[model samples]
Target: MVAASGADARKTIHPLFIRVTHWVNAFAIFVMVLSGWRIYNASPPFGFEFPAGFTLGGWLAGALAWHFAAMWLLALNGFAYLAYGLVSGHFRRSFLPISLRGALHDVLVACRGQLDHAPGRYNAAQRLLYIGVILAVIIAILSGLAIWKPVQLQALTALMGGYETARRVHFFAMAAIVAFLIVHIGLAVSVKGMLAPMFTGRAEAPR
Candidate 1:
């Protein structure tokens, strides 16, 4: 009984590699977003520019450099995370068996201000949201590549419906990611002890 209790008391919510990759991906995404905004401000996408204060790099040339640098980091780290998740079965264990009905139920529960705080499993809503974010990141990367090297990556640009369409897709993908981040941060703050696991790799024992 004592041994069982000890095991239960020290649950591992995330492994070391996952934690490291997660933080690195976060930093890369942040740099890309800010620098991308700066680059976009140099040429408005839809006849409107993002505010200068909200952007990075301070100039078009500097912003382009920062964006490309961060893009490589984001690609490498993102793919590493994906490969690890697949090979380790982390994705299957954490996000598999998701269904529309289950997600709807979780959404209703969340609406009622009830959230499952189980340390060993993610709720359906989390699984769905996480998967959605992953797809969005893939879209952003593809579209970005199309825009970055339209002449060299002509086939990719055409696949994305040409350079202009790819740019639009990239912009919308970034917007979706930003929206997800806002919700993610809000949920983290609302849930007690939610943020600690990402840092310490262990969640508080389920109540």
Candidate 2:
């Protein structure tokens, strides 16, 4: 019994540290999105505004306050997670060896509803999706900073094709991230017991 328990303990799929940082990042993103919507509504780039009920804060100033606070949390926490993921080899184990062919196969299988997951491992589709979203987040941050400080970060604004372009980029990046989030949430709920490991850390050992 003792030996079995020891083996089971090694099967943890989402370590406690990962869980903590993941939740913190999620919260930060949640706040940033809602507050960002409010900020965007003040001078919508697309000529339409998010429903006030779906936004954070009562007005532009309040939204800016919340957005800036959450932006710091997201940036700091994201850096820590990225450092840990790289140094601990977690990224290697979980999201690696990506290739066009492999992703295509996964997509095809997924479309057929025949895709499956290996315990404690990511499928190609999951890896690609995660990678894409990470990039999107990075883009959002850069474009947002440019929009938030066009005069101060003149170089960044220029890199992003000036202030007007940066705003559009930020909007599109946020939209992509939101779309990925919807799909991610749907999969988590639809897949049997898939969401438990993130909270509990351990999962059934692979046969």
Candidate 3:
């Protein structure tokens, strides 16, 4: 943990893999949000539509491209992290914690805005969030594909309650992921500045 001369005060900010894939995920999320909005505009929801001057072609076509492209970025960054975590042994030490009861307790605290006492490298609440996001991403991809090619995926679409129903589910899943991201960032700032550890790979407490 030796710091470079003159840069002694500033710690190492992120291992190479972490830093790279993190930014990549951030960028891809941004693109997904932007393109997703455009796609939404074509079909409008809740009686709101994309402005008249703005059009991202027909709804399905635009959404399909943007969604799949963003999916690749998310998947790439995710798998990279997976490999790194396993190889570096961080997955077990820093990521895995046996505390289902404690986790549930932490969730209650988080709901009350009392994150100061949350435990573990990621806290129970944070762990739940990360896990939820991963699941949501998978769900969104599957639901999206069902919607995109209902005819080809007729079985899946049927399982989802039909083509239009699958599309609705996909849209809802995207919204849920976005909501989770917002809350995640907010929670990070709430507790010990979470970004620093992601950047520096070190926190006040050992992983």
Candidate 4:
């Protein structure tokens, strides 16, 4: 454990590997999102294009390179993160045993701005959201593979309801991830000292 000062004491809440993978995954996702937007602009998936200025990669070819590079990074880093989480018992320790009743209660408490913030334990709402985001990421990756190699991965594309449907699913998964990122950043910034763990591998514990 680590320590801070006053009522906002801190402890070594995050391990070194967790910290590394968290930042790596974050960067990978960031690059993937921006470059993906540029790539999408080429085909206009929904008949509308993302603003070029707000996207990364100058053009189609550039975007494809960036997107593919980031995709591999995301996959490798995510796999490592998941493996470590499981092997280290982090997933069970932090997110398991979530009951529906407990989750609902926690959600209501969160709505009232009263969720607990104990060290080393995730609240029900956080556990649920985190799990949901993980599932979304898996969906995004699968759908992306279907879109990227429809011929080679015909089974996957067919499973996802064909090429166009897989494209739409990938888009929606990306949208969900973006939405989760917005909410995650908002919540982290809104709380004092909440961002320290990912950066310093520690967090302020309550007195």
Winner by TM-score = 1
lDDT of each: 0.90, 0.89, 0.70, 0.88
Rank ordering of all candidates by TM-score, starting from the highest: 1, 2, 4, 3
Candidate 2 ranges with C-alpha deviation above 4 Å? 1-10, 205-207
Q: Per-prediction TM-score, please?
A: 0.93, 0.92, 0.70, 0.91
Model 2: lDDT equals 0.89
lDDT of 4 by residue, 1-207 (tens): 334454345567888998899999999999999999998898886878898998989999998999998999999999999999999999999889877788889889988988876756788878888888898999999999999999999999999999999999999999999999998999888877778877887666553
TM-score of 1: 0.93
After superposing candidate 4 on the true structure, give the runs of residues whose Cα lies further than 4 Å from its correct spot: 1-10, 205-207
Residue-by-residue lDDT tens digits, candidate 3, 34-111: 666677776765577655334333466776587677778877787887789789976666556747787799888878
Model 1 residue 94 distance off true place after TM-score fit, in angstroms: 0.6
Off by over 4 Å in 3: 1-15, 49-68, 83-92, 95-100, 110-120, 204-207
Model 2: lowest-lDDT 10 consecutive positions: 1-10
lDDT minimum window of 10 residues, candidate 1: 1-10
Candidate number with greatest lDDT: 1
> Candidate 2 lDDT, tens digit per residue, 95-119?
9988778989998998898988766
Whole-model lDDT, candidate 3?
0.70
201: Cα error in model 1, Å: 0.5
Give the Å error, residue 205, model 4: 5.5
